[model samples]
Target: MDFLLLDDRTNLKLSIIRKLEQQYSFSERKDVLCEELNISQYLLERSVTEINEDLKQFELIDDMELVEQSSEIILFQDAQVSSSVVEEKYLKDSLEFTLLQTIFFNQFTSIKKYGEKHGMSRTVVYKIVDRIRKELAQYEIKLSKNFQLVGNEWKIRQYFNMLYYRIYKDSDELYNQSDILAVQELFSEIKLYCEEVNTLYLFKHYLLITLERVKRKQHYFLPNSFKSVEFDQKNKIYQTVAQWSERTLKGTNREIEVEIRGIINQLSVYRLEFCDLENDVVTEYTERLKQQFQMNMQLSEIGPEFCTSVKMTIYQHQFITPLIDLTLRAIDLEFFHERYPIIFEMCHTFIYQLKEDEFKFSKKSLFFNLLLVLSQQYDEETDKNTINIYVNFTQGEKYNRFIKNQIQIFDSFSIHFQPVIRPDTDLIVSDYLPQVTFSARNLIWLAPPRASDWRNFGNEIVRINRELQLNKKRK
Candidate 1:
């Protein structure tokens, strides 16, 4: 025979979830529960399974019924799995709420009633309650969330709460004083800074002051008034100070604009500088960045289509599985990243490859062409075979051949060319070559129009006809 014990934590969770039956979702409950309980998702799931089994043993079917009736658990599977986690989560949220209630509202009875109703020990309730109060007190006088301290730097009131909790835990005055005067001092300074400069740094200064108090615990007592406090709003000392000293000192604003202009001018003046390189390296690196950004956008836009489409199974089996695991792990790793080291390495490797190839542009051109074709052919008919065809066009030394073949398939048209820039190894054309232009080239780079505008091309053709007539006359 198995017996189920209704623990304080479990009871608190049930009460909390029932109260917030409308606002919270099953998934959110599960996540919050796991976090509060300090348990892994796997462990949380196992606990919920065990709890359900226990409930069945005790004939507590009504509890299960109550949960099922709650429409917040819209999906049966999610509702079934979330029971234990939600219970744990609710207990934590309740404790946090109770702490705030007791500290700010002076509603200490709520904490006592909560514990008594849930059959929890008053001592245990007080312990949890005290912890939250201590946390808030650390923030000092800034009790409300919206009453943010702004100066040369602004900080949220919550930061002060955390700070007070840290510094005054052992101090005698912390328990004696109901109102946190130290926190108020910082907040007042923030208000003054905001009034004068409309700056955010006052908050930062407040945090620094809090940190200093924490560092020197003996100097935790606040004086009646500060000497440097300004009497006037339009004081010359406050007006002269720059709001963002760090940015002004760094001088990155001027440098960035200058660098951007330099890059654009280089591209405009020497377009052939890109063409004087090998194909493979340049194409592989630049195409990777372009494809990565494109893939991200496509995934965001067509996410729902993947779930409902007939090719969902095929996409999951062939495409998503290969990348999703690594991608998710990389994202998780990014949260704790000090400086995005791995992505930086990938960028470095890509840039190095580009430099090694001596700046080939055709590879990038072919890559762009492949993307354009892929984007255009993106439909229900685009199976693995169709994708492979485009992929092969990008792979190896097949790009030039692929482009030339496509050009041949395009309709023939009249064209003329003149050498624009004749360097050591390559001749960059300024004018169209005679009888060389085709529908494919015209369509391929539709925006650029190869060398000249359509109107200019017509004028050039007319000019050539007159020149031919004159030469015939001279003959």
Candidate 2:
């Protein structure tokens, strides 16, 4: 049987070939195979006989003849995998490149297509893509944008890539592998890093625009700034924004803007550690403004309310709820009169799900009102410890035993909890959480948005009503 032989370094050479194919032509670069073989100066002196027989597994020698007597001669002899066509030959076992091609070409084909091409079962092709993902994780080889990792169609990227590549080929703008990488960098970092609600809105807006253009068979062009963002900066911004958003969504009662500020200061000084700007600088500025807004939680500091309205309607717990409502209203009316939207949202969330009326009016009103009323006094920095201890305690017969206890804890300082009334509504106020102190200066924490708290509270009423129905059924 006439057989082909490869050297011990064949695996490495194959990898180099794959990388080169990703960069340039897979066919014309066939002569450049010597570069990918990477035989060192020391290996030049070693005779083929002296080399270990285990190297035969790589098929380095064919019929015991030196394939190329001179390294300069790029000869093509019979090998296990032929080097005939770019699609069939070069990409023989390269499931990674195959998946990438699908994404680049936007060609959606069934697993059966891959199975038939590779002489494998449909299940085998699925497994190959899965293994490729696991193997290329170090290289960050994402098959497509918007790929969801879990669920039955875990290979969702495969389908999406095929579609995108097909679309790309038809489009006027030519996007090669390098351009794809650049676009990926832009979306993951620059778009994701702009953490401002408004900036995020813009990112979504642009993404929708890009996606829409692609859908309409239009060529897409991202701004030059988007394509130039460095890999490391992109990584940092993505990590920072991801962490910030996770914490904010949790409503963890940490200082929101202060934490974000630290992210900015780190980015500002990142030049000392690494020299690269690209899109990171632009994203840094956006994050900086978001951090600034977060630092100033005062209602008056936000812009003119203009067309916004601060509407407060009582639905439950009429007694104690008034204390919290009236105090927030006082701040809105006297200081942050312009930021009616925020105030209105705050009030809306505060009473989002209270019952219209509870038969036991006193008990109904007091506990329901207490929850919202207590939360109003807490700031962006209120600790979990404080909430657990001072907000829910039911020690004396007093209605707000929790607040009363908290007042003692702060020595009547809780009275100062009345929302800060700004003397100058037009004047925007800013403050900095100073570093170089004994505190954990680098940590900027955000209390997660308790939007769900109100929503869940409303849901709880329905749940209680349902339980009563079930109880009556059993009786």
Candidate 3:
């Protein structure tokens, strides 16, 4: 057994590898794997090599291998190792990572009990607890003396739900199969009343925890301020959940009722109206934003997809404020404020309009969602007539600052410029274009920027825009 210090990335890699191993044989393209893992090809290859080395130590040689790789595809094969062996090895080697699982899934009441069960000294357990506390602090959650998680209950549930997925992602027994199936059936019945994606897994985990707590005579009481579903709707869902639980868990009617009520309360916090953005209020708000920002976009140009995003943002803020708080906490505010200050400021102004109690949206949620929507909308406008431009510069920090300023200017005119080479590039705007062959249609070279360079560049951009429009008209 080995106790390795695992960063989040490494943990994710191991989980990915374990999942791949379970399939025994599968063919995935390199690009597809990279997209799934949110890593580059080079990083993915390195991770596979590292995972192979780890597998070797456990005498699982030839158990998993990348059988083939090419420009278009990557093939993986596993030698069909028994489930027991893999589960045993995973549990032994990843015990530290499993500590949170024990605390969460088992509802351990005290640090001493956890230490005794793990065969670790109290001091070692405390250190681990301290580390967990630091992690929880990122979400503004507190670990209490009774080994309880204290925070906005919604945030607590979200945190634990995510943690559960990460820890058991590779395991077939992540949740009881029957329980998951039950949740799926319940969701199908109630699908018309809510809009959700991949929520069954989380709901199953919630149900499992609720049942465990009930068995131990523990209860979660909803606050008086909690807004539940309408009585008739809640009762219908409660009856369905109760009937399923009675057959599945053999829970008493009273106990099942309590658990159903708790589940419904949590679900209410996440249920979103499918067509909320089609209303006049959201349309009026979108128009106000365009005028305030001096954007050239018309109401129709913003599209239904953008409107749907706005509705989700509103729902998140109004019903799932804690999730929005968690998202804001994860953002690098200072970096965005520095690089995209204009957009950031615009977000603030837009958020201010939604500050009324009726809207119930937090400033942070509005700012984050508004920034995302505005940036995408601006990019779409820019892409319509402008060419993609990849920047090449040598002066490091100074060049970086120059590029950021250039992006801001280009954005104002709805002119697209990549400033970096991405998969789909159209032109190069650089201090000096590199000699390497490129598929882009044009290149605009320049000396290092001077005070008048922006004016000259703006004029050139306007000329190009007119040329593109003329080409379109001719076609």
Candidate 4:
């Protein structure tokens, strides 16, 4: 995650761009802007020049002014390209980024030789490697004396997967095209359904690692946490991947099983639905927790779906390193844990029942996940969004905030303002049409919305929330 962050200079330029765009005046005096960014006018002007140069790349097609200094005021607009594209460009340009991908692919490159070919000093190369080595050490991985990643081979794969998955975003940047196709084909044949985010790239990263290691005659050493673990070899996906591994690796059956168990373990843990899994690990864990609730807590009101979700969640923490931090979203759970302490206690007590020898159960992961799932059940505010709305006007961020504030005066919990467009967005209020296609719905297009526009918006909200209530009642 540290590696994904841009250098301070690049970060400053982006911050400056965002700062100017956020101004309701839509322009900032050069001196004021420099003061706001805590930089000298000289550096500010040079950063602006750099920004202009990058914008010039699209100048042939982008006739509209995106970023400019009109006399004393620094004017900024959202570029035709997204912030992500800008970040990706900066990421690829980084020497540290290149070195990381180099190590991931080549595995054993001489840094001095690499620096020589790249016109960088040996000191600079090792400085970069030292930074990487420190980060890898946090994950219990070693950047070995041989310049290869060493440790639990599975963890090494996870470490790189996190790095590549964050940086690449499914681009052909670091993956083999054939491997993507084959993995996708296997997924289709198995009819796997996993709702965990970024699963496509997960398959890509692991498959690439598997192919690379297998081709090099490097058999994976199974982690102690997975020792003596049982898997449903009869599961269609498991059998399919196993057969593929056997045919491709041409290794002893034991080695092939090791690969299959490792891969399948990951695939199963992230699955949104495991009713199809022959072993149904979640169901087993769910049943155990349910018995505990019945005998100790005298509580069986927890839904089957909720029980399964909680169990699968703790199960995953045992094997998977968290791909992202989502603490803020689950903050409400802390209140619940304090108020209904027994629910939290029941969850806490159930964790001790887990296998001491095989599973690496994370108490914190379980706590966070319980918070996330339980929030929907107990936090009444979570259901307040009956008609989610995203306000984006040509007038930009400051104007959007003003409009959102005005809408809040309505005192309607049913009409929640979403920071971003979501699948359930009932309306989008903007002055100009968006550049992308969207499902046709209530779209208010008004530069200076009149009294009539407000009336129409209110009508639309009432209609949307009524339908929502009706649907809920029917359910």
Q: Which number leads on TM-score?
A: 4
| Of 1 and 2, the candidate ranking higher by TM-score | 1
lDDT by candidate, in order shown:
0.32, 0.32, 0.55, 0.61
Clashes of each: 24, 21, 0, 0
Candidate 1, overall lDDT?
0.32
**Whole-model lDDT for model 2 versus the true structure?**
0.32
Best by lDDT: 4
For candidate 4, write residues 1-475 as lDDT tens digits.
2432346788777667666656555567888888888999888878877766765653522522334556565554445654445555666667767787777666447987898889989898888788777767766777777677677777777666655655675654466676656666666655643333345565566667776666556678676544223656666666777777776664778888788776776674565333232235545766765666565322333443453456556556545544323111112344445333445566666766676532332444566666665544533322443567888998889989888888886664446688876666678888866554556355665766777788777666666644553343211
> Per lDDT, what order, best first?
4, 3, 1, 2
Residue pairs in collision within model 3: none
Residues 99-140 of candidate 3: C-alpha lDDT, one tens digit per residue: 665655556767788888879889988777776677777656
Report the C-alpha displacement of residue 447, candidate 2, in angstroms: 81
Superposed model 1: Cα runs more than 4 Å off = 1-44, 47-92, 109-120, 130-232, 235-475
lDDT of 3 at 407: 58
List ranges where model 3 is wrong by over 4 Å. 1-96, 107-119, 137-154, 166-172, 176-199, 221-300, 303-308, 324-383, 386-441, 444-475
Considering lDDT, which of the candidate structures 2 and 3 is the better prediction for this target?
A: 3
